[model samples]
Target: MKISVFAITATTIVAVFAVSGSSPSAFAQVANRPVLVVSSGVADISTLDPDRATNVGDVGVVSEIFNGLARFAPGSADPKEIQPDLAEKWQTSADKKTWIFYLRKGVQFHGGYGEMKAADVVYSMRRAADPKRSSFAADFAMIDKVEALDDYTVRFTLKYPDSTFLGLVSNYHGGSIVSGAAAEKLGNKFGQSPIGTGPFVFSQLVTQQYLTLVANDTYFRGAPKLASITYRMILSDSARELAVSTGEIDLIGGKREQRWVKRAEGRGMNVDIFNPAEFRTLFLNRNIKPLDNLKVRQAIATVINVDEIVRYAGKDVAEKGCSVVPNGYLGGNCGSGGYTYDVARAKKLLADAGFPSGITLRSVVSNASAQQPIMQIIQAQLAQAGIKLDMEVVDHATYQAKSRRDQSALVFYGAARFPNADNWLREFYDSAASIGAPGAMSNFAHCSVADSDIRAARVEPDPLRQLMLWKQAQQKIHDDVCAVPLFGLKQVWAHGDRVRFGYELKGALNLQPPITELTTVTRSAP
Candidate 1:
């Protein structure tokens, strides 16, 4: 397969919004306001509480209102730099078990809440570790306890050494620290009215309609340049594009198709695309026979045409993936032995596995419109290798539960983790962590071949050494043909002339349009 690299240089070329949807004079009327109108397709942003933020929409809202101890820089090309936020500095013991953090003084939470301190950090983190309070409780399992050493000092004792511990508690949505006083005062209502030490503070949430946030004037990072930001829920694809094209909204979460990219660019709008991409991996259940047969598995892997999948599934918005842990990031890419698209080899392997007559493989997938197309593409590709994919379409939740329960012979799962590869390799391939094993997040394939390497990688303190262990695990997965790696989801977003990203394009955690404090708006972009 030929590798393609595409990059667009950002220039201030501007155009007028001419698409027929909203009023033509809209831009002029809204030119003076320092409000950014973002069109997000997510319709279920019911909470602002970071711990309970299950969807990317809620996570995006939470990101604006909260700060983790450390965070990814605003316009960083890579997610590697661990910059301090609420925590001024942090250090770990030589054993790499105990972590101490010194908090920044005078950082205030929204709504005139008292100054943030070590106690607030401890309270927030402890609450996030509780299973009932956080959907990502498993992420915090490494923590034995969190203690406030003093008013500005906090300590965390870990059950074992974990190199990705900082990222898990620093950049992930679950890492957002809320004001303990605010949570107690507001109780369950805290999710709607969140208070944090971020650049922007929550102003109001209009349910499924939109959310509003105003600049935190006393923000430690300095007041956000944009006076306010308004996130609008525009679920319809046509409507969303029209809004951006007609200048009704400043920006919209773009569709993944290359054709959509072309349309947005043709209109002279700015299209922003970046990585570490979300991986769309094809997992074949080893617990099921035939698939349990190495030849059959290898045959399916050979026939898995990722290029065709990328063509059909938005080539511009995806990269041909090589590992279960996406192609790029701190994790090393050791995919020299990865499967390439070869139908002849697949046919031979299928015949050797006693599937010359063509075998039917049962599968289950989410019936969501975005997901169904990719599943159909997989079904079509498998047919080329004398394998009939009899996929049963179900709702999103059912698909996840059934896949985890080991009910499917084939599962095409698209996902992104917190820019780390260690936890990803463990939760997906380690026997003790996968679904069939006890307390599994998602081991859909029920794999254990890389269990030892994955375990070793997790506890390795040195970043390079830990990455070496992770590559070993990744290689094991590649050699076993444990799963077919598809393309990573290419994220694309388009904005009108009225707005330009305040900072350079950078990586984000699957939030379609990550509008950070650095995202800037012009008095008029054109």
Candidate 2:
């Protein structure tokens, strides 16, 4: 699936597009132009509605226009640092299953709906938990009830005490608060156009062109420094690199290839790279033939040259993934000591599985420029082990849709999950998250290799013990051969010197450039 949150595409880049809010006089055309122009490598945004967005690209925009009860520390990339947003402060009962939130007063919704109140917060959160209304409902399903106690206070009663609950409802994009009045007034069309109490207000979405937003002067935090922000979709990697190099765009998401990394540095641009990043893992359908056989799965794992694959995958941009949870992840980095690259071992396993001569299997992958090369490496690696992976390259979005239906024997998926370890483990290995299950958004592989460990980890009150449980769950996944934890991808975002992030770039929760109220764009020194 095209999750540039787990995304990478190859296409030609073009000039940035600018739209003036008002028709300018012939002499004033340049004067009314936007102060800042940015480029995003997304092919397109799914929806502006936070509840409907499944990909990071859409969530990026949603985050800009909404607030949650809490948020990742603004101006900081550390996912562990959480601070209040809509909720000025909150407290949990002694049991830790009940939460009381005191929202900030004087927050106003865009389009002047009125002051944001506890009723709006209650309505917004309940809508997100409603399975029929949100694909993200499963993330918040633990909440048994939500109550608005007053105009500025809300309460949540949970089924259990989950340490990740605050993170689940706030740091995750699904927790974004939308105006209840606006949502009802607009209905399904709200996704096309949305209203929120964020630093920016949605102005326009020109298909395949750009999504433009104007600053919210009355923002509770403060007015954004940039007068307007334009998200230009750049499909071509080479073009995107060139745009940043030539200063045609203030910022661009750089390609994962190390060569691109070096080239950008050569041009004197600043590139930010961080770890505990996306996981580019291969999921083998256990319900499918050959793959379902334990020996066959083992053989496939033994033959995969993960090191060589990373060699081709930009060693500096990525490294060997240790587990289902990437290194330094929330629960704690742990791996299921995978089989080494040994062709003989692979052959022996294949023979033991009764396929002495070898077996041929078909797999599907996205034909995106960056992905094809990696798949080709896997194809070649498998052939050496006498297993032929007949590769079918499909459009990225189609691959995501088809994979969820169990359409392929093998699937290559990538994602930058919420920082919590349980979020990743459960979505990939929980039966409840299996494809076609109610409220399923991920879990394309349809395998539940470690359901119990993950469940145990979710309820573990002790932080250290909880992390240990999460690690055990990842080990279970690796041992079961449900998927091969390929490598942890290091994300790169390059920008010209003129744009200031206003903070250190660590790791992002949603894998997008961490731009927020405190972010600023300063003119480069003359």
Candidate 3:
């Protein structure tokens, strides 16, 4: 297996719309205006409430319908580009534990939910802090309390100083503010019929079929150019390609493979490969069998080949990963060079751990288009050094259920977070987020070796010291062989030439080029 590192640059492949026969009446009646239809390889979004959103598919929809106190400047994933959204201005106390935000006046919520104010922000933050209410409740563990100082002013008192608090209030996850009145009225059904102050309003959802959104004419930024948007859930890659090629879809999530890129370009589709790449890692379950031994875990890590995995994923779509914290993130460090790949050393270590012959480990593998191929390549690579990986193929939902219950000895996971090391480290490596723990997240490794460094980095005031703490945590995790960092796969999407996204598409945190108030679709000359 050969290791190849590609430049971290956005690339284009040459990829707009005619509605399919099955499109709804809203899509048909918009002759004077354009209707943007988009397709992605997802069955459907699980929720519209931003607090409960656990994956990119749900966040993408929620982003269009909600506004946070702050937001990433459109078309950028960089944390430095964060700008004010519902909050016109904000300031923090001298200790950095208390933050204050002044809300923008006259920003109306959808469905007649009325204006957004400090009360809504307070209510939303409270909801986000409750474990039962939000998947990201642990993220708000730093907040001591949230209070409405006045109609337009909101204040947050944190338990400790957190450098990433600003991102927590930005437009990604729990930061997305929901209407207090609407949430209380709708109750559990609020996820289905969400109301917010974003540029788009949720119109309809048809289970596993599709979702529709209409332009919010009362949007704070201004009216969106497209009259409506049809977000269709097309899981089949062939069907999506056909739909986009036949003018049924203006944009479609693309495959992260070189062949797919060339094929889309051949069909005249404009392809966009953007950040932040979803970082993949193989987490070794310490509680499971032979993996309980540190030598066995180290042997497993030594046996696996990351270079082979990157080759299979294509250098254009994937970048070699070397840190427990993802590469290219703030406080990220890949300078340790990672563990050297040596099959002979792995076999020797396994023998020393009482596995003289070989050992078989079971993993629950998802049949999702993007995951199966990578897992298969890994299985073969592990077998080369006497580690047998028995993968139980299952549907994505089943895979999630089984993996959560600690059924897998090795968990292959991929995720992209707030472009900060704290977000990734705290969720995936912290002991508190270990599976089965209260308010558990995706800490599949049950790793606690770097808990002190991880916690200290959060409150470290000096920038240099803070980054050093983060690097120390990563080094500890790496030395412990808690997880084998694989590769970072960039997001791929194709759009029609007629679709003009008002800003240059550099990177989007939501995993899709956001359809904003500025985005427009040109109509054909009659």
* Candidate 1 Cα lDDT to native: 0.74
Window of ten residues with lowest summed lDDT in model 2: 6-15
Better of 1 and 3 by lDDT: 3
What's the lDDT for residue 312 in model 2? 72
CA lDDT of 26 in candidate 3?
Answer: 21
Q: Which stretches of candidate 2 lie over 4 Å from their true place?
A: 1-34, 333-335, 462-468, 522-526
RMSD of each: 8.6, 5.9, 7.5
| TM-score per candidate | 0.82, 0.89, 0.92
| Model 3 weakest 10-residue run by lDDT | 7-16
**lDDT comparing candidate 2 with the true structure:** 0.76
Q: Between 2 and 3, whose TM-score is larger?
A: 3
Candidate 1 residue lDDT tens string, 61-160: 7878889998876645254676888899999999889999999999987766779998899889988878677767777888999999899999999988
Query: In candidate 3, which residue ranges exceed 4 Å CA deviation?
Result: 1-31
Candidate number of the best TM-score: 3
lDDT of 2 at 4: 31
- Largest lDDT belongs to which candidate? 3
Tell me how many residue pairs clash in candidate 3: 5
Candidate 1 regions with alpha-carbon error over 4 angstroms: 1-33, 92-98, 111-113, 159-161, 184-193, 203-207, 287-293, 312-316, 344-356, 366-370, 391-408, 436-438, 461-468, 510-513, 518-526
In order, candidate lDDTs are: 0.74, 0.76, 0.85
lDDT by residue (453-503, candidate 2, tens digit) is 888878777888887888777777778788888887777788888787767
